[model samples]
Target: MTESSIEANYNRAKLEADKVDLLIAEALENGCSFLVEAGAGSGKTYSLNQAAAWVQENKWAEYRKNAQSAVCITYTNAAVEVIKERLPENSPVLPRTIHAFAWEAIKQYQSFLVKTVTENLDYMPDEGDFARVDEVRYTLGNRYRENGVQYLYHDDVLKLFCELLDNGKFRRMFADRYPLILIDEYQDSYGPIVEKFVEYFIEPGAAPQFGFFGDAWQTIYQSNKACGAISSDWLKVIRKGSNFRSAPRIVRLLNDIRPDLPQTSAIDGFEGEVVVITNDDYSGSRRNDRNFKGELPPDVLRERLDEVTGLIRGNVLPEETTKTLMITHKVLASQQGYDELLAIIGDALRDEEDVFLIFFKDVVEPVYRALCESDHAGLFEALGVKRYPINKKSDKIRWHELRRSLESARNSKAIDVVNAVVGSGLVPIPPKIEGWMSLYRGDSSTLYASSASIGQYLGLDYQQFVAAIEFLQPDASFSTEHGVKGEEYDNVVFAIGRGWNLYQFDVYAPMITGQVPIPSGKQASFERNRNLFYVCCSRPRKRLFFFVSIPLSLEFRSFLHDLAGEENCYTYGDFLREWPERTIAACVKNGAS
Candidate 1:
């Protein structure tokens, strides 16, 4: 807190900021490609935006003279929005998702693509092919017309663009158009086509300067084995090791967990507590407990809930000043388990808004949007209000009425609302909504009936969906590990060993303890488990409580003890015996003070 100490801290922060600027300047100046391995909580996005700004400020004259713009490619549309918001208006930096960027390229070079495709194909397109293309165009809401070839799906556009990029003329044209190509979350970019695109465009001594920003250790996408293959002798590799999100204790724990990806804490000597609680008395055998047997036994589940409840009550203030999160690896593995956790948290935090529900209601959201598209009279009829519209001319008033009705029915069952709307004949049901309902009601024996298939059926990754909806308010204090990434809390209770198909806790637990070597074939799985654990454990800014359902081997217990300290590592039985009294004493002391 001294003046000199404050100045030193300020200087340290400034240097960290400058490091990114220096990397960007070096890559831009030399026209050499680079990859920045920005770890979790590293300001990757901010650095990307700064790089964009640098290009605009320093190279704008050269770019403008050639009618070119600096292009930033993000992993998600949400990321694109963030980058767009951060950049100044008319900054000449084109920020877009990969798909959006591809679509734009298709639009810009439609004529060239048509010519190439026609020349490459053995047979000319017939009316049926054009009919299918028309369907695609309608589906994508693309209305542009060029040489009567006005139809293309997203994949088709990407394929055509890739083909065009292979042509030397088009490749040079693209490089001229985009002199600086920056890809965010590059590790998640996979697929043979994507690999070809990256290789073709980002070749050594290419006209455009390409920079990739990502963490290979955090490449949790199982299908992306090519992520690590992106590195080359010519590519400049920069490592951003300072973690600005977590406390020093959490950073140290992350380093211990994944020594391959060692990170340093930005804040010096920052303190936090890490508690590892295991259910050593669980009845399941190691062989049978790989997936935690899908659900915990009744008593064990109660004990786990009790530990979570006690932690929240003891460490979490009633005033809700400090944020708290309870993360589980499985959010929808067992509906019964999910409901029980919600019930327990609701009862414990009665009338408190701290326990927010995070879920992907994508299956329901589009239906709701469709229902809301109806006019006021139709919506009222659907809701059984039997009210006539007072102002027929104003669509805005009708929209407000529809919004209020939909808002009030937010918690209603999707089936009931859909039935009401369809039965009332308010509006024609969209085909997409009907298709979704069909999948939801599909045969239990079908692939879509399985819990693992729901996400794919709904056109989303389940973990990503859970992460996207963390802000929605609901009557629960539960979230998936993926959902809590990059988010901090004062208190965190993470439930591991849940039956998530992707995470093999049996394999991971042993790997963590050094009991077994991570199989070369399953290295991706190992890295994913490590990354998820790191993300969950590092979320707590002050206190972390980990509850593992399966019985832990002695080696695993020792591993937990080493990371959390023996004083903080406790068996479920030990915690139950000691924590209640400690909780009571703390509450009494706080009251007395």
Candidate 2:
């Protein structure tokens, strides 16, 4: 290797090898349990992998056999994929989401494996046997109804799962597995499910090893729909407080906010000025439309987005390194409509090589389209009739071919196919069919519940859905606040529009709710927003920008500025004040570059 290459490798090797043995030793020590407080970019995953290796090595050494395997649980599908990808080849670490792990464990036990879920209500007799689902929905909805609240489906599922585990089902499954349980983003797992895991799986004599990684600053979501935190009660806490992901200058900014941070080698000796633009001149006249109470008007936000795009085109380094993350405090409540903003941004960033965005509304379409392309056949088999499998397969193949034809046709956007498949008159729904097939939500009551139904009814069984999916015009990537957890970007710009104000779990609500004095939760929520902001900003590892569109309500605006560093904050109007003379020129230059 050349001198520089050898030196670079030596430096990385030294960091990796340093104290790695100590971490492993602690994890494997008998009667050992640890709750590690790892900040973003702190190699938390590395530590977890190291611990898993220690567990496996000890199992083989002590018992003369491989252990069941270490269980590493994270909150998001992306994290699951990341863990799986990052793990060393041939490593036996079993990283999965809590839900996936739960389902897997339940699958091993016959009674826990549910064949079907029947939702039957007395007044809604047409519904099937969702006895428990009905009760909890009624109970939670009734309580929230009087208070003007909406209860989600999985919230109750979390409570029910917890109840089952607390009652010993969870414990019984893990009784002999010798599985080491590792939790990531622990703050997001605080509901009954987590309590049950701790009480039954960790606290009891299960003797499984435990490794927890998460920042106390970024605990935004939990099953309880409340603020999440790293409680004082967790056993044997070890804080991985230093940030290896951020430059020293950025670390200083975070540390100024959080004084108790640990020291680490994530980022050191890097210097950069932190710029906070408080845009005060832009009046948010657009989002005030009375029709949508909790959304930033897409047009208004789009205007602000245009300005930020202008700045990025002019100033950001390494062009493609710049990524803008438009995060609202709440995705569901945004009035501006996520899809509309996404369509607009996709247009703005369409040509920019380095500039990318994470918007909530439009990110899933591509994934759905991709899945239909790759797994359309498997999906058909899983959901379609067994006796008529060949018939189904033939239809799917034809659909795939047709979609390919549509793309090959050129000039026409795929909306023609979408309309043909979903719109009126293609395949008339039987008058006997009570519910319209939902192309979006996969519920059985809906006549065509999944992509499978669309293919099945359209006689695509002869071809495949891949053809139909091929016609879908690709949109930009935008994730919900919840969606971007455990994910990071270098330059993050939050469009904390009206949605954050409308959503029930806005993280700012706890600050509004006097019932719980969880400033930490509120702070954590703000910090989670900030953490997400930091995550998106730190993602580039070079620059960060926050574009928080002013909301119609001053209250909402104040909440955003508070979370986004009031001193460094700016409004859309603020950009108009400076009117960077080169703004338009910058866009042209950046676009050209």
Taking the candidates one at a time, how many backbone clashes does each contain? Answer: 0, 56
What C-alpha lDDT, on a 0 to 100 scale, does residue 185 get in candidate 1?
82
Per-model TM-score, in order, reads: 0.69, 0.58
Off by over 4 Å in 1: 1-14, 111-150, 191-194, 201-203, 223-229, 268-270, 282-290, 318-476, 509-515, 576-593
Candidate 1 TM-score, C-alpha based? 0.69
lDDT of each: 0.59, 0.46
- lDDT (10s digit) by residue, model 1, range 4-92: 66345334644775776697778778888888888776667777877888887888788778788888887777878888888778777
lDDT of prediction 1: 0.59
**Deviation in angstroms for 2 in model 1?**
1.6
- Which candidate has the highest TM-score of all? 1
Which of the numbered candidates is closest to the native, going by highest lDDT?
1
The deviation in Å at residue 72 for candidate 2 is 2.7
Model 2: weakest 10-residue lDDT segment is 353-362
